[model samples]
Structures are given as structure tokens and as C-alpha cells.
Target: MTHRFVGVGALTDVPRVAVVIDVMRAFTVAAWAFSRGAERIVLASSEEEALALKAASPGWLALKDGPPAAGFDAVNSPGLMRSADLAGRTVVQKTTAGTVGALAVADAPLVLCASFVVAGATARFLRAEGREPVTFVVTGEDGRADEDLACAEYIGRRITDSDVEAGPYLRRARTSKAAGELADGVRRGYRGVDPDDVELCLEADRFDFVMAARREESLLVLRPLPRAAVDDGGEERRTARR
Candidate 1:
């Protein structure tokens, strides 16, 4: 089994499994949100849709565009998961790139969100389930983000059980052009971006589970892969999803 990589805007082909990478924050935020006991995350195609869904369910937390919408609990911030008491809550997430990339390749047999938090586990899953080629979709901020590429490269190395140290990839990402925007807050403005989120995103295998997506009536509901618990950072819990 082999692996391929594509930028956010250039996902021209599909594979047996599609793992979307958004290490800068989108997917990472979702993983951390779930860690804080978020019931489930509903991926919306647009901010309007997310807001509408949240309006339907009073308690649902919607990560919307612009300043926290009238009643939104928080924006798309991975750091919020650490400090917010989001237990027993539902999150409706709509992002510019990450979610879009996942939906673009939703046609695949499997669609999973990949960040450094689950990079190792994703590689293990690929290794165990090598029946076909897998593709890593690097959802850049818009075109290409250093963080997403770093996650993709790290996972690609892990697929072959190579000596992949998370440090270099992150270092490379930090020094790249887009990563600069992380500090400067280009697309979302300085207040919208959090350098801390980038720091947290660099934590490899931070979660015990990998987030997977399911398409339901045009809506992709994302949840931790069933029983996905990583013992000792879930590295040993490298079971593949069949």
C-alpha cells in the first residue's frame, strides 16, 4: 500500500481512504473539544448552516465566522477546549479549509480528520489496513499551510514505520510562509488566531482517539472512531478501522 499527498485546492483524485489534515487548528480544535466531553461534532458546509443548526438546538455550540455569533460558545479555537467546560455539549463546526477538504473527499470509503494529535494512530491504521492506497489531503488555510503539510509528511513517514520525529516537521512548519500568518493572523485577523493553538497542535498523539466522519443526509457527523482509546497516548492502540 502506498500514500499520496495533495494540497487543499488540488485534490483531483480520490483514494480508498481519505485522511484530511488541518493541524493548524480546525481538526485539532475538534479533537480537543471531544476530549473535553463534547458529545459529537456536526460538520457544516458553511457558517450559515452551522448557525442555523445551532439555532435548532439551543445548547449546541456553533463555531462560526467573525466575532462569536450572538450566542456561540466559542470560535474555532483549540485552546478553548482546554479551558471551556464543554462537557456534554454538541459542536457545530464550519471551517474555511479543513471541513471543506474532508467533504471534497467524502466519496472515499473512509474519511477521517488527521492532526498531529492522531498522526501516529492514522499511520498505524494505514499500515494495518494496507489493502489499498491512502491519500492525505492537506487543507491549507486557503492554498497550503505549513502545519497541514507537516502533519501529512509526518503521517506518511509513519505509514512505513520510519523514524519520524515530530519536531522537524513542526520546525519546518513554523518557519514556512503560512505559519507566519499563524502568528500574524492573516485570514482570520490577529484576534481570531491563537499562537497557543498552533503550539497545542504540535502535540503529537495528544489524544487517545482518532476522529472519523460519517455522512448523514448531506451532513457529516464526526466522532471519535468507536472505542478508539490510545493506551499510553494511544500509540499502542494502533488498531485499524476496517
Candidate 2:
């Protein structure tokens, strides 16, 4: 089957299935929060909406994403997700790209949440389904590089035909050099975050769960699996390290 990666706004000619990636923060944070036992996530279209949700729900909602200069409760950092006690709670995320990208493709026949953390599981899900055209929507900087592209390329390599060349996309996805430079320029930066997080995000098909995005009430909710439940095969057990 052919696997193509496109920007959020570039999404057209909707495919049967689509995988959305916002690895730097949005989708990565969502994956991390879910792995930490969050019951669910509510994606907001803007920071103001997310703040309102958090104010109404208090501990039930954790906020992320806002102007970098103006800081919010969370900053789309996957590292912060490891520190929060999200057991049985839900997160309200408002990212510039990730959340917007998800909303852009909400009309697709099938939309799945993906990132470096869940790349392996996502790939496994697509492979098991066999030859079906799949789209990996890389939510970029208004459509530029950060981490979303990297996560998409990684997943693309895993599920696409063996001959497909995902190198250009993969290269575009690696922001380590840029991330490192930023870390050095800033104090108390994310230098301590496990490098494995990046590598794990790049691994193809590590899990069996496919997260589907849907509108619940006025919010966006991501649901895992559809009708058929595939055995997790202990992948959940591996998440404890984070």
C-alpha cells in the first residue's frame, strides 16, 4: 500500500484512514498523558478555551500550549507529562498545530492520534490491516518542521511498501540539532529528557492500539480501537519506564 505524508492544510482527497502527528508537543503530550493513566483528553481549538475548561474542572483538566513568551500551566513538554498525577483524569490541550491539525481532518473516514511514542503501535495497526491507502498528516509549523514530521516519517517507513523512500521526510522530522541548540541557549531547558523518547518516537509499530479522534460534545476526544480489540501483548507494560 502507498503511504503519503502531507501537511495539515494540504489534506485533500480524504483517504480511508489518516494518522495525525504533532510530536514536539501536542500528540506527544497526549500519548504521554494517556500512558500515564489519563482517562481521556479534550483537545481545544485555542488556549482560552483550554483555560476555561481547566478553570471549570480544576484538577480534572491540565492545560498545555500557549505563547512561549507567556507560559501556561504546561508547555507541550512530554517530560512534564511524566510528573503529573493524571490517573483517572483528563487533559485539555490547545496546541498551535497539533490540535488544529486534528480538527482540520476531523471529517476523515478514520483519524488516528499518532506520535513518536506510539509510532510502533500505529505502524503495527496499519500493517495488520493490509493494503489500504493511508495518509500520515504531519502537523507542521503552519506546515513546517518541528517533530511532527519526524514522527510521521517514522510511522510511514514502518507501514508503507518496502520500496518507498521516506528518507526526505525522516530527515525533515529530526529536530534534535535544533532542540539541542535551544536547550543550550536557555536555562533549565529540557536537556534531561530521555533521548530514548526521540528514538522511541522513531520506532515503527510498537503498540497495537489505534487512537481515533472524534467530536464529543463541543470538544475533541480521542478513542482507542474500534470494534475489534487486538491483544496489547504487553506493550502497555513497557510504558512504565517513562
Candidate 3:
């Protein structure tokens, strides 16, 4: 099986398995939190739900969605996740693009969550397993350019067996003014974050876990690939160029 990339709205030709990216904040923060040992992530489609879940859970960390503007919880900053103790903790996250996009594909045969930081790992996992007809869904923010597309391009390169290059998508993402603005915002508020985290998210094929999204009761949960299923395999790898 081969993989193709498409924007969020163009999901009419949904595949059996899909990987969604909204790296700017949602999934990036989720991935970082997981790396920090977060037990699970509850993705709230709205702020109200996220807060409610947090209130109900007492100790669960909460994040609100805000884009084109600041979110209720200081926007999506990796630094914020780093500073907190998320080990074995649960996070309720709401994001403009990430959570909404994941829900849009809830009916997909298989939905995997992804971010820039784990693009390489996602590609390698898909290749090793040979999952076919995979769709790299870029959850765009209000139809504008964002980190989702960039992360898609990075993953597209890794899983595709074709000769097509992901250079154009990667180049566009690197030069996007929006990305620059977001980076600047982060730099201004938190000086310790390496500008390379931004750059690293743009790199192709970096990690090994393919995040999986599933609904647990009413909340959408995302977490790393289970340890037992890491070696599964089946088809040819393909990139979604456009």
C-alpha cells in the first residue's frame, strides 16, 4: 500500500488509515508531554469541554484552544509542557487545528496523531509495517498556512517509496511568515527554547512512534504506538506530494 497527503477539508477520499498533523501547538505539546511521561492525552474539541474535564479530573492538566490569537492557557508552547511534571499525568488539550482535525477523521479505519517532532518515526513505522492507502491529513488553521502542512511534508518524504521530493513543501514551510511569527512570539516570551525545536519539527523522519487517536467515552485520547504492535508490517511506502 502507498500513502498520500491531503489537506484536512479534502478528506473525501479517506483512506483506511490516516495520520494527522497540527504541530504548531496541539500535537507538538501532546508529543512533548508524552515524551515527558504523560500517561494519556484527552483532546477536547472546545474550551468548555476541556475545562469541564479538568474540573472533573481535579489533577489533570488542562489546555485551551486559541489560534490567530492567544489561547486561554498561554497558547501552545512546548516550554510550558517542559516546565510541568506530566509524568503519568493526563492532559486535556483543546486546539484550533489539532483536536478538531482529529475528530473530523474519527470514522477513519485507523487514525494516528502526529507532529513535527515525530515525523521520522511515523514514516519509519508506516514503512516497516507497510500500511497502504495511508493519508497524511494536514489540519489547516482556518484554511491558512500553518505547521500542519510542514509536518505533513516531512512525513510524506519518509513513507513514500517514489522518487518525488518533499523539498517544495519543506521549503515553503521553512519560509512561511506565519511560522516565523509564531517562533518570534515564543522567543520573546521564553528565551531558553532552542530555535532548533522549530527547525527540528520541520525535519523529515526523526522519530518512531505513530500516535493513535481514539475516543474514550466523550473525550478524544492520543498516545504513542503500543509497544507490542511496533513491529507490524504489510505494504509499499508512498509519499503524498501535493
TM-score of each: 0.85, 0.74, 0.77
Each prediction's number of clashing residue pairs: 1, 8, 12
Prediction 2 TM-score vs. true: 0.74
> What are the per-residue Cα lDDT tens digits for candidate 2 across 148-215?
66666667676755454445544555555435433443444443344444444444444445566776
**lDDT: the better of candidates 2 and 3:** 3
Q: Find the number of clashing residue pairs for candidate 2.
A: 8
Score candidate 1 by lDDT: 0.74
| Each candidate: RMSD | 3.8, 6.2, 5.6
**Which residue window of length 10 is worst by lDDT in model 1?**
231-240
- lDDT for model 2, on a 0 to 1 scale? 0.64
Off by over 4 Å in 3: 66-75, 141-146, 161-171, 186-197, 203-207, 226-228, 232-242
Quick one: ranking by lDDT, best first?
Answer: 1, 3, 2
TM-score for candidate 3, please give it: 0.77
Residues 109-197 of candidate 1: C-alpha lDDT, one tens digit per residue:
77788898878777766665564677888888554677788888898888786467888887877776655656666445655556576
Tens-digit per-residue lDDT, 1-242, candidate 3: 56676777877865677888876666777777787788888888788887778778777877754332332343466655656677888887887787888888876766778876676667667666565778877776543565576666667666764354556666777676656866786677643244554665465434455577776676668877643344453221221110
Error of 2 at 95 (Å): 0.8
